[model samples]
Target chain A: MDLLAGIFTDYTLRNVALGAALLGLVGGVLGSFATLRRQSLLGDVLAHAALPGICLAFLLTGTKAPLILLLGAGLAGWLASLLMLAILRSTRLPEDSTLGVILSGFFGFGIGLLTFIQHSGDSDQAGLDKFIFGQAATVVGEDVLTMAVLGGVALLLVGLLYKEFKLLTFDPAFASSLGLPVRGLGTLLTSLTVIAVMIGLQTVGVVLMAAMLIAPAAAARQWTNRLSTMVWLSAAFGVLSGVLGAVISATRENLPTGPLVVLTASLITLFSLLLAPERGLVWDWRRTRNNRRRIRLERLLLDAHVLYNHAELTPESLAQRRRAAPARAKEELEELAARGWVTGRGERWELTEQGHAEAHRLEQAMRVLPKALNPRAEGGAGGAA
Target chain B: MSSDFVIVLTAIFVSTASALLGSFLVLRRMALMADAISHAVLPGIVLAFWVSGGERATAPALLGAAAAGLLTVTLVEWLTRTGRIKNDAAIGLVFPALFSLGVLAVSLYFRNVHLDLDAVLYGEIAYAPFNTLEAFGLNLGPESLWIMGGLTLVNLLFVLLFYKELKLSTFDAGLAAALGFLPAVLHYALMSLVSLTAVGAFQSVGAILIVAFLIIPPATAYLLTQRLPVMIALAVLVGAVSSVLGYVLAILLDASIAGMMATVAGLLFGLAWLFSPVGGVLTARNRRERQRREFAARLLLAHLAHHDRPVPAREVLEEFGWSPAFLAQAQQWAQREGLLAGDPNGLRLTARGAALAGERP
Candidate 1:
């Protein structure tokens, strides 16, 4: 209750929360596009690449302005994204290696620049280092306003150009054939992605920004298959986690805001992976178990019915009818009797009226009802749509 | 040895060793594993320092790093094998958590210690020379130099001894396993080696920059060569060259040697990315342009061949969206090849050019 009260009443807390919420919403929307493109690692690349840009910005301006640093970061992040894209298009190197190279290499240079700048004694205080792992306590009204404006623009761009962006992601070749400037639109999207990453730089830093860009979108994926729905859900998840992380971090003295935000997003992903109604681990496991049990019970009913028809109705025949395990069959028979699908105790099992219908359903399943009867057999692994 | 020379040589040694391991990694398409190991080794370093009670021995640190590296691989493998998340997603998941733990350790406990966050992220290569190892009351130069040198020697020997096993497993794990080579075990061994190398370089290049040493040189060598042996040798050369060049550049700019080395390495990669004759972008682009021009010239001749009379070059240029310069160039090329006879009024294909155009179908 106090945390909630702090969120509403405390001005600083409110600004931090609002900034993080905007960060999540814009980041989630843009991250959804990157995730769908299978360029999840691109976020990591941009965030790392942005470091050198921030250093360069500081070197040029000699000030600690958030907007100035972010502008530098945005451009740097854009450059890295462009370089990766260019490398991918031109070089024979695989995507993973290309991504790895650009990320580490750019980041190494960034680190070099940072250390050099610090050593040169231009600023005894390494104010830019705070952007590494962002501190929420420092975000003020101006930063919040800037974040809102930038995030709002990013979200609006995604909405306004949704069709073009969607086509570009799904089928760039087709989109180009339709006379869309696929390359230009792609560059535009890349810019928005960097902007989203830059906004989170002072909040989550670079490493965790990579996580926020994908985790929320990834979690939203488990809940829905539609891209539009995924975008909305992803945004919501991002906002919730960002605000929640900010609020929770406020209750503590020494917690870094960005990592906690990432942890929160990661927790959301974990929950979504485990608990979402559709395409979740729990849902798939429950469905698989129920289907297996249903198949087992129905098969048992058919065996008993067949044995009774053949006038082999004793417990020995019942045991004979149950091939794999007598104990499993006996237990299943008890379950069947309880459900009124079978009758006759003392190790003798007879089919009830419901049992006859259920047996017919299983028999039908053996031929033409695979889809309706068992969904697990349809999708090969993990129940992914 | 002079400290400058020692620093440069140490950088070269560490880089070459990383490049050697990185070649196999790049081939196996696990190049990003270098990045993962670099970040994941942080907690191990901290824990080793804390648990081993600040020992001077490198064993505890290496043990912690190996454990951490192996754990990262195992965790990623387990996650992937579970078929739940993607390989990239698992990587994205594991590194941050471990890295953040390291970050938290830095912020909380190690804040008061000499093991600051800067040292963890970017090692003090400049200070490496001042920290000497003494044995039997004899000065042993820089400790990082000795440690990194020893680690490099071990890496070289390991690569030499297991060359065949490493080659087989890296290229075709299935075949190697079928032959009872135990590729999985070999994989972990290689990962552990990579971990140890990262840890060794960590104090000099910090941890993340170790990835630049591991991946950049090998990737550059990959662009230049195909054979594994040549690739390894070239990677060493590349690393040594980049390290020296980076040192000189750092001296001139008065910048961090490690960062400059990484920057130089990145520059070298950019050069290879653009100019490597085998698969260089410029080479491919040149090849494409040559093909496009040749095809256009042939088509131009073919069009002329369809006309029995001399056709006005301007008319042809107008019919196609061909620039006059391109048409003139094409006409000049045909004339130079004795495939066309042209005046200012009109151009005509010679019999050879006619036959060539006719034969194209």
Candidate 2:
């Protein structure tokens, strides 16, 4: 309870939580577009590419201020994006290979710069490596303010150009036909993504920031298909993971906030993937099972109706007709009897008047459902065996 | 041997080994899969380190890392099979979570272990020489050099033995499967080799440099060559060159050798991107210009022949949507070749130009 109170009373804890929330907000908002566009790894590339910029910024300014370092990181990330685009257009290398090249090349150059700085005997390089494995504990009120401003700008731009981005994401060729500046919108969106990545760099670190951008959005995607709802839900999941993870790490002695937050988001992603209502794996499995059961019930009902005139309806005969076990047929009969579609005593059974009606309806439905479902109705001989 | 020689040799072996598989990776467009495996194998390495009680059990470590790599591939495939996410997003999701788990494990539990996070990303290749491999109380030079050299030899054999299957499946998996080659088995085999190489190289060159050596050299060679064998050969050559150059540059600059190696590899790729004779950026532009001139020349000739009269240059420009300058260039080329004899504003097709147009028209 004191840890809970610490969140509200302690300045450092409040700042860390706020910083995480800010990173979550911008990352989730922009990440929806990234996942939708199938450029999910772009965040990874931008984050890795920002390292050189951070080192260069420190080299030039001789300070480790959050705003200056982040600005430099953002510019370097932006430059990397531009270079990526140029390479994509001018070369035949596939996008994955190109992204791999930019990510590692820029990171290696940054590492070289970092080691150079370290060998140069600079004592102030201490805090700069924190950007790698982000020390959220070091986040102060000023850093929170920087995150808020940067994240706010990115969010505002997303709000203003929401429709254009939506159109661009779904159908850029159609957008071009509509006389939209598709390329300009795309570049702007990519730049916004760069901003989002930059904001998360100080909070989640370089290697794990990709999770912040991807996991929340991917988790939210399992919940909804609508763009607007996806963006909001994604942002909410991000915030939830961010705050929860920050609070947990704050209370714990040895936990790192960045990986903790990522792990939390991943758990949420796993949960959503398995248990969401429509698209979740569990739900899908249940749906398939239910569908199969329904089909079996319908087939059993039709079989009983077909055999009613020829032979006395018995569990033995029904089992033979369904190629199912006698025990299973008896169980299905009990279910149908409970539904008032069958009347039975001992081993014998007969269809009720309601059962006859349902069977007839099922027959007609089977014959016509295919025509209803298939517009072309190529093979019109639809009937139950 | 001097530490400098050991370091350079280690870099060369690691680079060559990675570049060999990197050729197939680039062709398969699974370059980032190497990145994923490199990061995801951390926990496996860590666990193996703990379970084996030391780092001396390299086999267990490699096995654990390979298993982890395969698990990563499986999880990604499972996620993509769910149809909720794409292959790329699935990849993005699975690796970081596993990597985070690995990082948290390293930081929380394995403090005394030699596996620090910095070494995970920026491997101490410069210090690799000091960790000498001793077999039967005899000094056997750097362990990294031996491990990487063995990895390079194993990759070379894998490629040579499976050359036919790899080539067929890479270019046309459908046909390879139709021919009963079982492309799926080949794919897993390739991924396993990649994982083994990644784990072997991870301790020396680090993760990002592994990506660089795996991707940039093969990618650069790809821009220069069209055949698989040539691409592989060229990639190894480029990797070797980059290692040597990167070592010298790192020494001169007093920087991270691995980082300088990747930077040098990037420089080579940049040069190849700009200057390769096959589909180089500048060559593509020149080819586009020449093709445009030839095409415009044909269109004009065909138009003149069809009309059977000299058409106004302005009319030709308007009809074909060509800019005035482009039209002038095409007309001047045609006239200089004696394919057309006309004033500045008129265009007439000569016999040879008409024959050229008729041959294609």
* Cα displacement (Å) at residue B156, model 1: 2.7
DockQ of each: 0.44, 0.66
Candidate 1's clash total is 0
Which pairs of residues collide in model 1? none
Q: Which tens-of-lDDT digit does each residue in A1-385 have in candidate 1?
A: 8998898899988988988888899889998898888777788889989999999998888877888999999999999988988988877787888888888788878877887787788754466677777777788999998898888898888989999999999999999999999999989988999999888988888766778888898889888989999999999999998899889878866666777788788888889888888677888788899999877767777787788677755466767667646666677667778889878877556777888887777777776677667877777666765
Clashes of each: 0, 0
TM-score of each: 0.78, 0.82
Fnat of each prediction? Answer: 0.51, 0.82
Question: Candidate 2 residues A216-272, lDDT tens each?
Answer: 999999999899999999999999888888898986666788988899999999999
Which lDDT value does model 2 have at B316? 85
Model 2 RMSD, rounded to 1 decimal: 6.6
Error of 1 at A298 (Å): 13
Where model 1 places Cα greater than 4 Å from the true spot, the runs are A173-178, A282-385, B53-57, B113-115, B125-141, B285-361
**Top of the candidates by TM-score:** 2
